[model samples]
Target: MVQPAQSPEPDRSPGPARSSEPARPSDVPADHVVVLFGATGDLARRKLLPGLFHLARAGLMPRRYRIVGSAPAAEALTDQEFRTHAQQAVAEFGRSRPEGPAWEAFAAGLSFGAADTGAAEPLMAAVREAETALGGTPRRLFHLAVPPVAFTSVIDLLGATGLAADGKVIVEKPFGTDLASARALNAAIHAVFDEARVFRIDHFLGKEAVDNVLALRFANGLFEPLWNRDHISHVQIDVPEHIDIQGRARFFEGTGTFRDMVVTHLFQLLGFIAMEPPVALEAGPLRDEQVKVFHSMRALDPAHVVRGQYGGYRDEQGVDPASDTETFVALRVAIDNWRWSGVPFQLRTGKALAEGRHMVTLGLREPVLRMFPLETRAAAEGRSNELVIDFDDPGSITARFLVKEPGPSMRLADGDMLFNYRTAFSAQNFLEGYEHLLLEAMRGNQSLFTRSDGVERLWEVAAPLLDAPPAVRPYAPGSWGPDGIDGLVAPYRWHLPDRRDATP
Candidate 1:
């Protein structure tokens, strides 16, 4: 087993002064039934149900576990109808096809119900019947795969139906548009389920390599000693996607790149990179460390931030013709703590970029001139070493180091020591981020989930940009973000990962 960091005790102070139950163990809950709200929705069809099927196929799901899809507008689907829907989802979007034995086995646990978000009694009756059929007081898990606007109503319904008793809830991201709403949502959720029972899901946190960051830094001795500001010059967390907002105009309109990506995904990455060692790797201790890192971060400076919108974003359906909503954002934030005092952590994310690059690069300070001879000194000036942790589809880790050219004459070349997931673990198949996250939720592990305090801190750091928005620069599709973004990294440019090189 990997050992926990020998760090100081985690802060025991309450999060956001909200009422919460004692923390639970990071183990799978027993005899549970997961009720998925908005079950016929796009997310359920594309990711959640397929993830559950994958879990069942791998024998990772609990023996008595059941999945009941519910939607207010959905007609009461027969078990056959629900199983058919699940079959199509897995066949189309799953990691693998739904084979006979595994498909039938997984489909055996499928059921469906109709429950209005505003009225939960019908759902409550259905769940009671499910538990009775399961032959015990099975733990209830409600996954709200619905929109942010429906969150409170669902929570209220869960409570009214008595489904919140000994139940856990999984909430999707964009917890709220801003800090106040986030706090409000937390309060409402807390009223229904305790903090320990709430799982704030951010699928990126469940990625294999994304989780590997903690392992790479903590488990290995080679990187930990050099992880701080003294040895590292800067950190770059870049997440630029190749696709545009053609279909998601309404979502992109309200939630720009900042709220959509930075507040949740990139900030979590920053936490993993900058947090102090945790007392333990349990949910509370780990999240406490992340919350501290967030608290240590200085408010994002506007001057260090740049925003951009794709050229034809305004012409997209449902978007305002005069929309200034940013589809891309690049900003430099400083962690105001001992380990990363002077380091500038540049975070950039956008839509319709050159490639779907998702990686974090730690640029180490250049070595001293005394290490190299006079002849090769010039070539080694700006050739700083960098450690990159990629969160692409299959994931990878790479170290860029300077090496002497084969032909001698003190000539130098940059060589990479790469570790691709496929190259290292060829026998296993890669799971989607949501698949891993959903499995973890079923297993009652909150370590990969976002915490309420962490969300609040993210909003705090992003308050300036949220309050007085920056001018959204217009950039053509298939280009790196606005030209000003290039200046943020100055001597170094963003590392663009080719889609061809990305793992499927």
Candidate 2:
């Protein structure tokens, strides 16, 4: 069934001054304190700090709240200093830094606290101080911006320290290096916080385009009619990046393309794209459906999945002369459910590739009994229709379908039409992944966040390729990908738009 296009309900026109993005429900509550566990790190500086600044600048954050940064030496970093730091990052990061005192007030709420990993004393004390200082009776939220190694200890400590009482920790991806590890990590997190308090993030879920994907299907009458196996042949998702892993040599060295990209971002999105309609758009119902997709995905044996590591793109500083790490991966998966039994989902993602971009492509099954002559069918290449969602491109949603050429010919030709969201609606000045997700968690809106079981299922499905590595294809810098990636789709024959742009 196709999702019908939905009309804005309950005064969708956003109210007030919080976000420039979309107008959220006015009733949306904003009452909570957000603590940053690692406030000095790169992730904190680039994403977390600036994101919090965005929330404050936009008024998405509450007026009565505390912003605490905890890590080693939390006492040394004062509220003013941390706020100033956040201000600078926002100036460097915010798309259009909102003018005036909004920035000032946002920064003022920012505070710094030194948190200890081994013992929760300093951390708990710091938290207590922030609570007391910020006015005392607010909900506590801990954003774990630390690396994976410190996860177990920090979560355990938070529980042992009673920091998780009204706490919520935003866990980053690659939660575990793999499936078994993911399970262990989940267990540790659950030991402290309940499943609801643990928000596993897949940034793509926060992207307007990503969420619209579901809406495009569920809320549209036109697409729902053709959403099933009968109308769709395959789906292709590509997250390509041209940047090599230089600084991330450590992370990438351990996590190849499959673990880094496909497991979290690609599969997470797939679960959303392919899941059945939930009982409601409520968080639990939606996530439950996605979990089913993760469970239904065909288990890819080493043979079914391909892992590729191109030459010359080793550690940025040349850490390893020979890195077996694969910078690229492509796999064909089938969903055995009744709705999409025979459909194929082609999933691929990579960094250090020939491109720096991402997109989701849906190729509808070809129309039957070619009414046109064989010559015409052969020329059109048998593509019934296709829809491509380009995230990094000039940012537009487009449909590739058969339209009669104007005037003469009267022949069916493929013409593309685009629905530019930015052009259609004044693009809402919304927060990026980090800020948006942080606020959602704060508001108890788990709609865009990942569930624990979803994370474990992701690892469970992708774990097979760890040992069953596929052929390592090769591609050059500024190149689309390895020589034969296109041929991999020979069975279904997906259309390559001219030369694949070195970017997604």
lDDT for every model? 0.79, 0.70
**Model 1, residue 64: C-alpha shift (Å):** 1.5
Local distance difference test, candidate 1: 0.79
Give a tens-digit lDDT track for model 2, residues 1-504.
111111112122343324444335562334456778778787887887767655655556654666777777644576667767666776676543634555545555566666665655656665676566556376788888888888887787788777789678888877797778988999999888888888887777777677677788889998888878888888888787777776777777777778778877888888888888888998999999999998888777776566667667663664475777888887788888998898888877766665555677788776666565433442546555678786542355678766675786556666677776556655445446676688788877898888888887777777677756766776776666666566666565544443332222
Tens-place lDDT per residue, model 1, 419-440, is 8886776423455688778777
TM-score (C-alpha) between model 2 and the true structure: 0.89
CA-only RMSD, every prediction: 8.9, 6.5
Q: Per-prediction TM-score, please?
A: 0.90, 0.89
Model 2's C-alpha root-mean-square deviation from the true structure amounts to 6.5
- After superposing candidate 1 on the true structure, give the runs of residues whose Cα lies further than 4 Å from its correct spot: 1-29, 74-76, 370-383, 427-429, 497-504
